[model samples]
Target: MSSRSILLTGASGFLGSVLLRRLSTLEGNSVVAAYRSGKDEGDCASGVLSLGPIDGNTDWSDAWARPVNLVIHAAARVHVMSESEGDPLAAFRKVNVDGTLNLARQAANAGVKRFIFISSIKVNGESTPLGKPYTADDTPAPLDPYGISKHEAEQGLLALAVATGMEVVIIRPVLIYGPGVKANMRSMMWWLCRGVPLPLGAIDNRRSLVAVDNLVDLILTCLEHPAAANQVFLAGDGEDVSTTGLLRRMGASLGHPARLLKVPSGLLQQVAGWAGKEAVAQRLLGTLQVDIEKNRRLLGWSPPVTLNQGLLSTARHFLESDQT
Candidate 1:
């Protein structure tokens, strides 16, 4: 493959930051780090072209005046506490739907070869029922505002591709984790670091998680892989781990024994709902597993980093950040 100019949205975010670093080290690749605010000077690499703030007001045609061979649409209104409190549907649509459509239209006009969308597995559903996992062929039935927005974005992108003869690739990853992770995963890491005992040892719900590196590798593969075009893939580490198992592994990575006690799931759910953390509880204790056989067979991609290695790397990052 020849050198490609790739525009990466959300370059300062957790996943984007990791992708930016990886892209910086790759040969024959130029990156444009699109931010929704001021440039992150500390995280910007030598080859990264920093462009600030791309919202509804920003003229994308002008912003994307330069030739961009590929676009990885990673920027979106992520699901968080502050976001969920507001009109979540509208808020998510503003960025995940509108922003994505704007960029795809501009990319199409610019004759960009491929548009890679970083969607969430929540587009399928929140949880997988017993004895079944979600596959790419399954119809999307998003359960929340965030998931709905991503599904809408996927539809828009696919429509644009069909109309313009462009290629679109959608990657729905489940619970991505690694260095610089935030939200509940970060909280979990913090608790484990402090050796705080958790009452989640009894939960046997299985969830699929993908490492940052694995996701990045898949993104790169989709950039050039012919089979990836006009395809949707569910990606993960191919190993489902329960909440308790994950905690134990995390403790092992941090060089500490797992500090967890058996707690009834129903009681925990009630307490979480009382505390206005029902969503958090569901995610932490939910059984959302994804089947990655399609991605494996289609792209021939497997997670490069194992669960243990990924956990250790994340633990090391927390340690380093704490010291600094």
Candidate 2:
């Protein structure tokens, strides 16, 4: 591969940071990382560019000073556990939808060959019935504000691609786990480390997840592959795991076996509903698997790292970081 000039957004985020580091170390990749913090004075020691807060009005003149051949947009208003905004949908649309289209329009005008958008499986729906997995061909049915925003952004990007002739690649990945992971995944690790007995053994809901390494690999593939242009793909590890399976595996990786007490799924759901935590319970006891056959058929890609390998890496990082 010849030297390719690539610009990446969300350089400071969990997924973006990993992708930035990987791109920076690869040979023949002239990578420029774009972040949303204006506090940093000029370019940093690592050559990351600060674009301030990303929104519809954010400027990208500095990034376009040099020719950028490709763009990987991984930044967005991610889902929050405690949303404080008065209008949650409007808030998400401001960043995920508006901010994304703003960047895409500029990228098209600047003659960028490809723009890769990192989307979420929520676009398909919240949960799936047994034996049914979400595929790229299915009609989008985003339920929440965040998923709606991403779906709208995808539609806008595809329309822009048709009008401006700039190729667009959309990837919808399920729950991603790896080193430096936070939120529920990290919480699970913490509980396991403390040897807390969780009443989640009887829950038998299948879920799909992607490793950071596997997702990054797919992103790199979409960056240049002719087949990836103007296409949407679902990404996963191909192997589905239940809630109990996930906890047990994570616990094993952390050197602490999960102590799960078998509890009826119905009782857990009912109790969670009464406490206004139905969403959280559904996540734990819901089936949300994705089919990644498109990725394999089109790009000939499969998750290079297995689920166990990814979990082990996350556990090792958690241990090292916790001790420090």
Candidate 3:
């Protein structure tokens, strides 16, 4: 294959950084990595372009000089529970919905061959019942502003594809964890390292998570595949783990004792609700799974790395980082 020009958004972020590194290694890819700040042209990617606050009015002529072969959109206004912004939905829609559609319009006008969008499983809702994991066929019922914007983006992109002849692929991934992971999962790692005994040993809630690398692999798989056009796929490590089981695995990787003790799930939930930590309680005691058979059947993809392998990599990074 000949060299193909690809434009990637959010190259400075968590998943974006990992995707940038992977795309840069491709033999015939002319990668144009877009970021908001912190890197000048050629600083990180050979063709790094600064995207100054994406919105409907954002210009793309300066970024894509030539028709792009592909575009991997990873940027979005991620929800921060303590966000300073007063209106969360407006904030999310400004970027995730409007800005994303703006990018799609530009890509379509520029004759981009394919556009791969990174979405979230939160679009399907917070959790699924035990033994009844969510699948792509489920109608989106987003509960949060972030998920709502992403679902809207998905709809907008699909419509844009129909109107402009641009192929679009949508990927919805659950909690993505790998080296340098942050947020709730990272907090668990921190507590484990500090020898904090968790009261979740007997908790049987199952959660599905994808390693960053695994999610990236799926993105790459969808980027060039004809079958991925106008398709929505879910991604996970294909390993369903209980809360206690996952913590134990991470503890093993960190060389620390999980120090897990049995606690009643109901009591845990009640205390957490009383303490204004209901979300945390639900995650620690709920089952959230995804059926990724579509990814396997259609894309012929499998998680290249095992869940334990991904967890160990994350643990190693935690140990090696300044946080330790």
Candidate 4:
């Protein structure tokens, strides 16, 4: 692969920050890291050329004055609380759909070679019916606004690729966990660290999570690998960890024994739903697994970091951060 200038959206996000750090250390690669607001101090450390608040109207001709070889669209409005109460479709479409098209249009005009989109497994569905795991070939039947928006964006991207002849690679990754994570993941770490007794021990639901390091590795491989061009791939660690098993491993990583009360799964679900946290309960107690054999066979990619290693590193970061 030729040394190329890459434009990375969502440079301040969890996955994007890690990718920026990795990209900075590589020689002969120039990165244009875009963020919606605020400057990421880490960008300076990573030597990324930072661009802020870029929208559909923002003139990217200046940034693309030189040849841009790749564009990684990682920016999107992720899942949030109360999808029913808000117009999440508009919110997600603004950034995930319109914003993506804006960048892709400019990149295509600039003669960019590959456009790698960091999509989510939610595009498949909120939950897999019965016992089947979602595959790359599954029809998109997104349940939430965030998922719908991403699916729409995928369609737009493929359409743009067809019209402009730019290679497009869409990566739909499951729950991604790593150091410096926030939201639900951070909450899980907090509970484990405090030894909060969770009722999830009884739940036997299986979910797939990818380590940030492994996800970044796959992104880099896709950047240059010929097989990745104009393809959609589902990415995960290939191991399905049950909620009980996940908390147990997390406890080990946090230097604490698992403090769990094996409660009835049905009762817990009812209570969680009644408390208006059905989404949270479903994610924690329900099964949403993915099969990644396609990624392994097609790209010859495997997770470089194990689940234990990733969990340990994440726990340590939280531990150290809490002290400071």
Candidate 5:
């Protein structure tokens, strides 16, 4: 964490962009921005490099402009709602697994001290029984292409760490939400802001979520903490909220009523099955909590932002963005 040069991948992405800004502003930290496509006009990094279409064969010769102290690999083939690929697992492996190993090997060769991988909670299976939250020690049971790819990448990174002595820190975060969040979290916010009546009021299941800022804080901690090396840490806000509670909080933050109907969870699941939206229903009603006790005990780290604060920030951003 001293005066060191850091190379950051996916610098223009949602979470990555916020990390880029924060890393760039820190005194004595020189940040190199790496993106896959067009240049990020708002990038404040000292160095910018384009890594077009990451895969097994990406040429990363330009990433090492200086002696890099760390590499935060945030780029990957993320999960999509409607996958267009003919072979989704193969496609994900090419990028998330192969692309990650390719970069890590190169970073090790270049004498990079540490490599931080942003993994997902999906690596620990889909859902947990209400109170039995997933721990970092849980057996990995990735069900989808994206999660499998991440699990493979993590295994590869650990092997590379042993072989090359480059510290590997893997972080599995659950449902990260904050300003500029997209996908389902954003969609939920949109529904709340519009006062749409949702049938999720009766959901009593627990879901753990981490704010983007909180995840970034943990990443920064891992970058320097000695106890973080070669360790897998689960990240969350440390507060589990039911779907109904989440909607209500978001509604309050957005200055709107959730307007949620007290529909029974069983009936909703049945209806979702009939509509071929069982996957969506499971996410809305099922339990997917992660235990962050390892994070607290090892790194003395707790989420810097509370759930309410995070939701309020996200809601304010949504309102401001909608106006513009």
Candidate 6:
């Protein structure tokens, strides 16, 4: 086996930053860390390049200079405020779809061996049922512009792969949580730290969340695994948790008791509607999970970090970061 050079975009993101650090430790591989802005302080990779903006016009020559063998595209337009947008889909397509395809095309042209795309579980619809979970083979039914763009990008990548013979691997991850996490996960941590009395104790919904370390492990597994070639995988920590269950676990990790009130899910929804938080209500009350057995069976991989361990690490980071 020859030494391979990898171009990793979004190296500054929460998951991407961790992925970059882990990839840097590979014995014989060269990892190029590309970020839109901000420096990666812990970066000890072969090269670190500043990508001004990851749009269609962005140049990949610097990243591909060393005969890049693999391209891990983790940067994407994940958040799109559709209501305030004039052309939300088009805006999303510019970065998620067009920009992604552009980068994949460049990778193919540069003789890159594999293109690994980090997508979202939104491509498999919003939520799952009580017993049923999402699978890789399920038909895509993206309900939002962000998901729609990702699904389109997946299609484009497949087409590009067929035309250029570049192996493409897509991994769709659900809510990823770990140290340096942001968005809803971060909000949850903040609320927990402050001892907010959340009324989610009665909400019995199972959601699948992946730890950053586990997700990075899966990404690394897909990089060189022959069985993962041209495959779509659902990334998860394998253990599902309910709202109250997760709160309890996270609270323990933060060394705080979970201050939760038992409120009916229906009443919560009604109150959320009155307070103009229907989306938040649905998310809090919904069950979103995926079946990762296929990823285990096919690639012989499993989440290395247990959910509680990961949560502990996340909580520690949050408390430490806040004090800094």
The per-model lDDT (C-alpha) reads 0.84, 0.90, 0.89, 0.84, 0.91, 0.88
Model 6: weakest 10-residue lDDT segment is 36-45
Residues 134-220 of candidate 5 have per-residue lDDT tens digits of: 999899999999999999999999999999999999999898888988889888888887788998999999999999999999998
The estimated TM-scores of all candidates read 0.94, 0.97, 0.97, 0.94, 0.98, 0.95
The candidate scoring highest on lDDT is: 5
Off by over 4 Å in 5: 39-41
Pairs clashing in candidate 1? Answer: none
List candidate 3 segments past 4 Å from native. 39-44, 322-324
> Whose TM-score is greatest here?
5
- In the range 1-324, model 2's lDDT, one tens digit per residue, is 878899888877888878887887778888788877764322322356787678899898788888898999998999886899999999999999989999999998888999999999989999998779999989999999999999999999999999999999999989999999998999999999999999999988999999999999999988899999999999899999999999999999999999999999999999999999988998899999999999999999989999999999999999999533
Order of candidate numbers by lDDT, starting with the best? 5, 2, 3, 6, 1, 4
- Put down candidate 6 lDDT per residue, 41-70, tens digits, no spaces: 445678888877677877888877787999
Candidate 4, residue 259: lDDT: 90
After superposition on all CA atoms, what RMSD does each candidate show versus the true structure?
Answer: 1.9, 1.8, 1.4, 2.0, 1.2, 1.7
- Candidate 1 vs candidate 2: the TM-score winner is 2
